[model samples]
Target: MRREWQVFRVATTYVGTVVGAGFASGQETLRFFAAYGRFGLAGVAVATALFCLFGITVMELGRRLRARTHREVLDHACGPRLGRVMDVAITFFLSATLTVMVAGGGAIFAQQFGAPYALGTLVTALLTGATILAGMRGIMAANSIVVPLLTTAVVFLVATSLHDLGVGPAFSQLAPHPALAPARSWWMAALLYVSYNLALSISVLGPLGAEVGNRRVLLWGGTLGGLTLGLMAAGMTLTVGAHLPEAAVEIPMLYLSRSHSQVVQWFYALILWAEIYTTAVACAYGFAGRLGQLWRYREAVVATICLALAGSGFGFSQLLAFFYPLFGLVALVVLAGLMRRSWRLGS
Candidate 1:
């Protein structure tokens, strides 16, 4: 029973790590699954399965090796020579992801509250950097509080939207654009989405699993996180299908929240900030960890804050658009290598 509870706790943390500003705001869903039209639900299923299977693989691998950081896990998974390559790729992607989260938070603030995006980005960078510098206890404590509130707010908004528009009709309306591919092929879209997210998740999930000190906890935590993401994807699919046009705007989820009440709107804005903070912290931690490993910086915290602030200055939408595809390619390579290693290990 204690183990089961730990599993739930760890899972929430993993879920919180992955479901950052983009997931909370419905922008990621809009860009990935919902963009696929009716087949979007199919994409969601594929993404969920990928999240669960790969998430478990990552956590279990970390548990087996007692990995203290993502570097250890990747080194074991990819072996010495290839692991070096994977390490570089993962670090680069992590930095870009951090930039995206910082930028996304700023965009949400500006779009929803009429604040300057630069101001929002700077504030987000400072808060996230501070939390990470406080150590693992601080990260876990912050996540425990924020994730539940964010999940509840999203559930309320999605549930209310579903009630307004019957599920069947909502899904049916999206049928016209089934199998819409962001890239050249449907398979590529699905693979890119999974690979990109899994690559980024490994840094947080690996160390997180090690911290829990139990394989079962890692398994359950990963499962829970994947399930949460799946449900969020489904909810976003419905919400997007019902009101597709809203997704084109900057703060679609906020627009959805407005339908409920002013209180809900305010609640969601707060939740969005929390979600963004969680993501920024995870990404920054990953980058800082790698940097610390490579250098003898006296003040790692200050260095990380500087890096995040500099990255955030690079416009939000431009950064996301550029990194999203670049990371997808890098991640695909890493995923292929991991799969090959798994095959050999099994054999």
Candidate 2:
């Protein structure tokens, strides 16, 4: 029973770390997979496979190396020279991704509540900075509840939206949307989607693998987590694809939920924002932690919040579209190294 509980906790941690603002809001799925129409569904399949494979490899390597941080794991996977390069890339990407999350918070407020964008951005930044200054314990506790609620809500929204659209028609919409798709090819989009998410997730997952140091536990947990992500992506793709140009908003999940009722929309918007808040806090904390007091962590937190607020002007969708793909492309090198290292680790 205790072992099973450990597996469950690890699986949930994996899922929670990956599912954030863009993801829970359905924006990530919309652009990365749903935009390509039926082909996007195929892309989700490809991404699912990679998520499972790479997730396991990451954990296994973390366990074998007894890595204290993702940097150690990266150093082992890539040579010292290349690993140093990747470390800098990961650190920079951490801030970039946090900026994206802050933007997402503003999108949620403005799009869902008819609130001012600037107000939303400022509020998000303030709240995030406070969370960082106070420490992560509260946010981490909140996430334990938020991730499950957010997951359930996503499944419900997707099911309802698909039923209203008719499942056959939803899946049959073969016309591509392609407005802000990161890649022209569906397969390439899938690759980028997994790559970027893995980049963000590796920070926590690596440390987790070292803490557990159990191959069986990591393998089962990662596989389950990957499969759960794939399921959510598939559901979001179908729902968003069915809605078409109308669903091409900043907060697609809220848009879909509003069709059910204004209350549902409000409910989802709050949940989505909570998830975004947690993610922003996590990102800011992680980025500061990695800096290791080169500056005071609180000062780093303040600086990050200010920078992220400035970047939120680019808009959530635009930032995710541009930066995510770039990060994914660079992170692909780390992924390739992980695969190569895994071969020797297994031996």
Candidate 3:
């Protein structure tokens, strides 16, 4: 029973870490895959396979190394010198992730509640900081409740939106939404999507591996988590592809929900905020922890979140357009290194 519960926690945490505001909001889906028209489905499939494989490899390595933080595992994978570089990169990326989520929170609040963007961002920052101050316990609790709710809401929103939006005609039409990702091909987009997300998520996942010792638990837990994330990403891509009316908006999912009904829109708006908060807490915790043992962990987390909140003043789409590709390219290098290292570790 304990083992099963641990598996469930790991899986939910994985999903929660990956399905941030940008993801649930549909902006990330639109840019990374859905914008490719029908070709995006192929990208989604590729991302799914990569996600499963990568998730297994990361957790397995973490468990074997008995790593408490991403730094130890990364060092083992890349060796001291390059691993140090990767650590710095991961820390920066985590900070960037928090910034992106803050911006996403602001977008959600302004879009849904007629609240000021900065106010929304500040609200999310405070919530995320409080949660991170509690350490991993807070993150696990947040993901356990928020991830399930967010996932259920996403599935419902997508299903109902599709029923209203319809898919067949969407595929039949070749209208390219102005908001599609800039990757030249669907494959490139998929690889980039998986790469950057892995780079960002490895923070929490490293600790996750350290928290459990069962090899079967790591394997199945990681695979199932990846599969869940893939399904959500694929479903959102398909839904938004069919209904690209809100492709221009930062929170496409919210836009889609509003199209169906005011009640659904308001409900998902709350979910969007929760999604944003989960990722924000995860990123902030991960980033702050990597900086080493400070006088207090809470102090570290507060500093990190404040930095992110300050940096998040840019608009959501603007940050998505710039950061996802740049960090993605870097993450691919890291992923390749990880694959190479893990191949030998398994051998």
lDDT per residue for candidate 2 within 1-347, as digits (tens), equals 47776677667667777888888878888889988989999999999988888888887877877865578888988889999999899888888888888888887778778998788888887887887676534444555677778888999998888778788987777469767577789999998888888877777678678877788999998898899889999999988888888888877887788778777878888888887877777677667657644787767777788878887888887877678778889988888888787677657
Instruction: Point to the candidate with the largest lDDT.
Output: 3
Q: Answer with 2 or 3, whichever has the higher lDDT.
A: 3
lDDT for each residue of candidate 1 in 14-81, tens digit (9 for 90 to 100) = 78778887678777777677777777778788888878877877777776677656788788777788
| Top TM-score prediction, candidate number | 3
Candidate 1 yields a Cα-based lDDT of 0.77
For residue 257, what is the lDDT in candidate 3?
74
Q: What local lDDT does model 1 show for residue 136?
A: 62
Cα lDDT for residue 168, model 1? 81
Candidate 1: where is the Cα deviation over 4 Å? 176-181, 296-298, 340-347
Error of 2 at 184 (Å): 2.5
Candidate 2, number of clashes = 0
Q: Which residue segments of model 3 deviate by more than 4 Å?
A: 165-167, 174-179, 345-347
TM-scores of all candidate predictions against the true structure:
0.91, 0.88, 0.92
Which one wins by lDDT: 1 or 2? 2
